[model samples]
Target: MKFLGNKSVASFLQVILTILLCSIIVGMLLQLLFSFWVKNSSNLNFPLQLNNSGLGEFARITTPFPVSYGFYIFFWTLVYTFQVMTAFIIFFAIRVFTFFKNNDPFSYKVVSSIKWIGVITIVMSSLQFLSEVVINIYFNHLDKLENGPIAYVRFNPGLSGIFFGLIILAIAQVFLEATKIKEEQSLTI
Candidate 1:
């Protein structure tokens, strides 16, 4: 069945891509806000009440995780910055895709912006992965007074998922742009 004249397939694909793009943008914004909160409040101490002598001893002996206030702030700031950049990229990707799908000439500026955004997202995600690994390794060898490294390691999965998702989205955008280029070339010929 034909829909939207002869462009049913293209229209359908564009609609789905637009929805996915919007969802990613919203998710990135929420993540940015959460990272900001974590960074800002990283220094606030949360007292834990201990009734058991064994638990109290464990807590006391541990050197209580040294709050590297600066590191925490820097890490989260970087995350927020990258997420916001990724959102902008997604916005432009949707715009470019819609434009091309409608048989309109694609904007070179938008295409260039997507390319840079994809590259930045990939680099930022890599740095985040490395930072998390380093933090986990350092925390694992903490003294008896310090908290166990499990907490640091435990947070890895969620962070990794977000990073991987961004990478996948960026790659998809590259392929989508490539197809648009091919279609434009065919039309020109």
Candidate 2:
């Protein structure tokens, strides 16, 4: 079936984003439960395995598994931040698409929503990076290193989302200008 127009695509996206948002909510809940379980579990020590096996070879093993409190806190913090910010971004995206489906694609509210999405994207990416730093710090602490040369910054830096957000900001700027031109044309008649 062919999509009628922009509305069709927007409506479709709205549905998808709604599903994703719901999933995020459920995921956050599950993670919380899991963290609680881990924290309260009696078996504080489990098998710790690290395998760097070659082709058709066996594996290796490491020390026992001991989940530190700092690690637990860091994990939960990262999960909560990433999940909530992601949900925020998707929620705003849904609003933007809803505007298109409602036949007001270039309305002020729509443009504003896009701008918000862009800002939120940038913020979320930064938070993701920060999360990595938190985990790295936790590891360094666990290793008993005062100032060891260690870093946990991911190489990619999650730029794709930031780039996409910047593009959306550009689109919002274009819409703002086009909206002005349309108003001027209407006034001439």
Candidate 3:
């Protein structure tokens, strides 16, 4: 099997990524509709319970309460933005694969797409981290003022995302250098 061209892994992944991209778009649209419906509907209460966790004493929240509309909208907006960013990353990946299918691995378009993916991933990861922190604080404190710290900081899962973004950025840099070298070779006699 060839590394590049229509019959190679890149082509297969391109097809898969295309399908995934479509699915994400459709899901986002559905989520938008759901958000509108939830906003207009009344008597809907969100219950938050942490005692169900197998950890006996580790769990803090035991009572269920309704979340505010402002928080709900904010949370969903953050989540939606994250999904959009993820779709952009997938879109860029698909572009990269398309270039691979065309046997143009070192093209400027491929390098640019890869770089965008890296940059978006980094920004998306930062947003996710900040949102997670805010959400966690809301859940833990439930907007109650107590004699303690302003916010309880916890280890966030988004750190892994930042690491992956940095890795992608490094890969993009390598690809840029490779493209430069390839262009130079083409120019040489």
Candidate 4:
């Protein structure tokens, strides 16, 4: 049950991450193509949920409206950007696993990858929060039926994701200090 080295858990995880990375890329591309196809078809009416009034009311309320092409593209762009960032996080995680498998726990690459993961996670979380706000406002204006505040914007900016990102950053700092100590010890010996 070793943490590092060949044929260990790290190596197995690296392989799994590699596969996951490929799958995400492929799936995203396919989704983009399908989205375009769906857009071109005239028969399909895109359903827009006006509000989350209540559990029973929400399920029954749905309005089919023609969303502008520009808005549709913009929304998908935000979704795709988030997905790409997610893929990058996974890619960096794979790099960390690769280092571990090679028994290089204190390598600069490992520390850098971990730091990037934290930074990306924080950015991704914030971007998602902002995008949600923008989409809500846009939809509210689009919904002709609702006269006042059709979409209520929640003040709750997803703090949990940001907190998790900060924790990861702290872990990266610890890894950095460990790397420095390891280097100093090697020099002394």
Q: How far is candidate 4 from the true structure (C-alpha RMSD, Å)?
A: 3.6
- In TM-score terms, candidate 3 sits at 0.81
User: What residue pairs are clashing in model 4?
Assistant: none
Candidate 3 C-alpha lDDT tens digits along 111-184: 88988998898798788777877777775676364333223445476777788888988898899899999999
| Residue 163 C-alpha lDDT in model 2 | 85
Estimate, for each residue in 86-161, the C-alpha lDDT of model 1 and write its tens digit.
Answer: 6666666556556556664344544565566656666666666777676666555552347533333433434554
Which of candidates 2 and 3 is the stronger one according to TM-score? 3
| TM-score of every prediction relative to native | 0.46, 0.73, 0.81, 0.85
Superior by lDDT: candidate 2 or candidate 4 = 4
lDDT of each: 0.59, 0.71, 0.79, 0.82
Q: Which stretches of candidate 4 lie over 4 Å from their true place?
A: 41-57, 60-62, 144-156
Q: Give the TM-score of candidate 2.
A: 0.73
- State which candidate, 2 or 3, has the greater lDDT: 3
Please provide, for model 2 over 68-143, each residue's C-alpha lDDT reduced to its tens digit, 9 standing for 90 to 100.
Answer: 7766777678779878888988998899888777776666777788788788888877776677676555655754
> Scored by Cα lDDT, where does model 1 land?
0.59
Ranking by lDDT: 4, 3, 2, 1
Error of 2 at 95 (Å): 1.0
lDDT tens digits, residues 130-182, model 4?
88788777766765554532344345577788989999999999999999999
